[model samples]
Target: MRIAVFTTCLADALYPAVARATVTLLERLGHQAVVPADQTCCGQMHLNTGYWARGLPVVRHHVETFEAALDSCDAVVAPSGSCVGSVRHQHAMVAARYDDDALAERATAVAGRTYELSELLVDVLGVTDVGAWFGHPVTYYPTCHSLRMLRVGDKPVRLLRAVQDIDLIELPGADSCCGFGGTFALKNEATSSAMLTDKVAAVTSTGAQVCSAGDSSCLMHIGGGLSRLRTGIGTLHLAQILASTREHPCPVPEPRRPARRRPSLPGAAR
Candidate 1:
């Protein structure tokens, strides 16, 4: 089972480790993972921020990159629900919005084959426990795009539950948004901060050693708050958690300071 990885914007720039862990999990399962070196942002941020027309080129580039990869790969997978949600649900809409029916059809075809990491493991591969070991008290947060947009309900939890020696705790208000809606955090700083405060409290109340989510963007947001408050709880992506094994365990990531790289998404093919 050869799979292609579509490493999204945040993961590519800010959290390459998460993308690498996705490949590690796939290879550990005896499936070959190939990264289509040309893939980049699926124009999700452009569309989300009201640059629908400008996003069409990004959308078209995404469709072209993966459409080529799908020629030989069994499936396309990413660790991000937000980017996958855009590919699956928004790519075609961006095309059709400008009367590009040919591009729209191509985007739809590409969208059909893309999957988030957990969905690929659970639904496509029919394996919940991918022979992983974590051995830590962890709580899982389902990001908004994966929860509402992708409807990947409980698939991540199912994967986490199967880890060896892992003590999974229930997150308080698990379904509530972490308030990291990309630019929403920037545009409405006070509201976003307030939401983040609530989310941090909920995460702390769980008494888990780490907070886990499928999206790196959300983890970064939650992690920054945890760092500022000097909470010992760390953040780990689901792929990293699943990629953890006794032979080569994933070290608990320290809460990152707000100082990080500015995301510059090139045509990773634009």
Candidate 2:
């Protein structure tokens, strides 16, 4: 199968390795992976930030970039569920706002070929284990957009469970948001911080060395909170874990001091 990797803007800038891992995992599974250079932001940040007028050009750029690859490849996969959701769910809304009939048509075609990592793996590739070999207990944080908007429940968890040497733990309150809704963080700083504190507390409660999810943007936000608190817990994207093997291990942050105690959930902490 010919597949194109749409490395979202956040991944391109902050998590390039995640993008590489996504391609590596696909190729290891005996498929062709393509990275279209022109791919950029999926206009999700803008769309969510209520900058519809400012998002049109970005929407156009992304649509054009992915449309070419979508026409050629059997599927277009992204490591980010959020980005895939944007392309699949929001492109039509954005296109319609401008009344650009061509853009709207192109948006529909492009969105059709895009799939989040788990969707491609379990739905298209028909495999749970991507033959991963990460040896550690990992906790999961389901990103809000992917969980609520995309409704990509259990796809990631199912794949994680299939990996050899992986101990997947249930994150208490795993469905709660990580408080990083793009501009939501900036617009409501205190509320965001409070919410992030709750998420970090949940991460610490997991007593696992790593916290992972399908979205890197959420990881960045959660990682930043953990980093700030000087907690040793690390955040990883699910693709990174799925891509790990005994030969080529997923790059994890070096271990620091183990957490002193599992943090209690809000209102329950003593």
Candidate 3:
């Protein structure tokens, strides 16, 4: 299958390795992965923040970009369940709110053809085991969008379980949100921090060296908090784990630097 890779904004900017892993995994499975240069954010941040008017153009751009790639690609795939959920669920709503029925129909068509990485691997490619091997105990956290919005239950877990030498442990409160609902974390830092505190605790309790999730945003939130506490646990995207093999094992990610503090005004406090 000729797959068009929709490298979401977060993956493109912050976690390019995740997108690279997705492409590598697809190619390793003997499928061609084509990344459209025109692809951008799936208008998720804007829509999630209730900026419908501002998000319309972004939504339309995504539809047009993918629609243009249809001739060269068999289907569209993204590593992010959140972005896929936005494409499948929110794009048409943006169009409808703008009274663009024509665009709405087009967006719906594009959305129908897009698939999250696991969904494409299991549902479209019809393969569970991608010939991967990782000899380490790892736990998975199901992101909110992948669990509730996309309803991609067990697909990711099923794929992970199929890996040879993988000790997949159950994550306590696996379905709980990692407190990174895009802008929600920024808007409600106290609540978000409290939620993240619980999440980090649960992750530490699993005694797994690494925590994996489908969405990079959630991982960033969870991973950042873990890094601050120096829990010695790392967060990785599912694509990175799936892309690993006995021949080429996935390297443990380097520890992230804590957020820098703003400089104090000169001669103000001292």
* Root-mean-square deviation per candidate: 10.0, 5.8, 5.7
lDDT of 2 by residue, 1-270 (tens): 999999898889988889988999999999999999887888898898889888889989998888788777998999988898888888888889889888988888888888899989999999997899889889998888778777888999999999898878898888878888888899999999999999999989887889999999889899988888878888888888988999989877753554578778989947
| Residue range 1-270, candidate 3, lDDT tens digits | 899999999999999999999999999999999999988888999999999999999999999999988778899999999999999999998899889999999999999899999999999999999999888889999999999999999999999999988889999988887888999999999999999999999999998888999999999999999999888889889999999999999997766544577889978875
TM-score of each: 0.94, 0.93, 0.94
Off by over 4 Å in 2: 255-270
| Candidate 1: pairs in clash | 267-270
The local lDDT score (0 to 100) that residue 255 gets in candidate 1 is 61
- Model 2 residue 204 CA deviation (Å) reads 0.7
Clashes by residue pair, model 3 = none
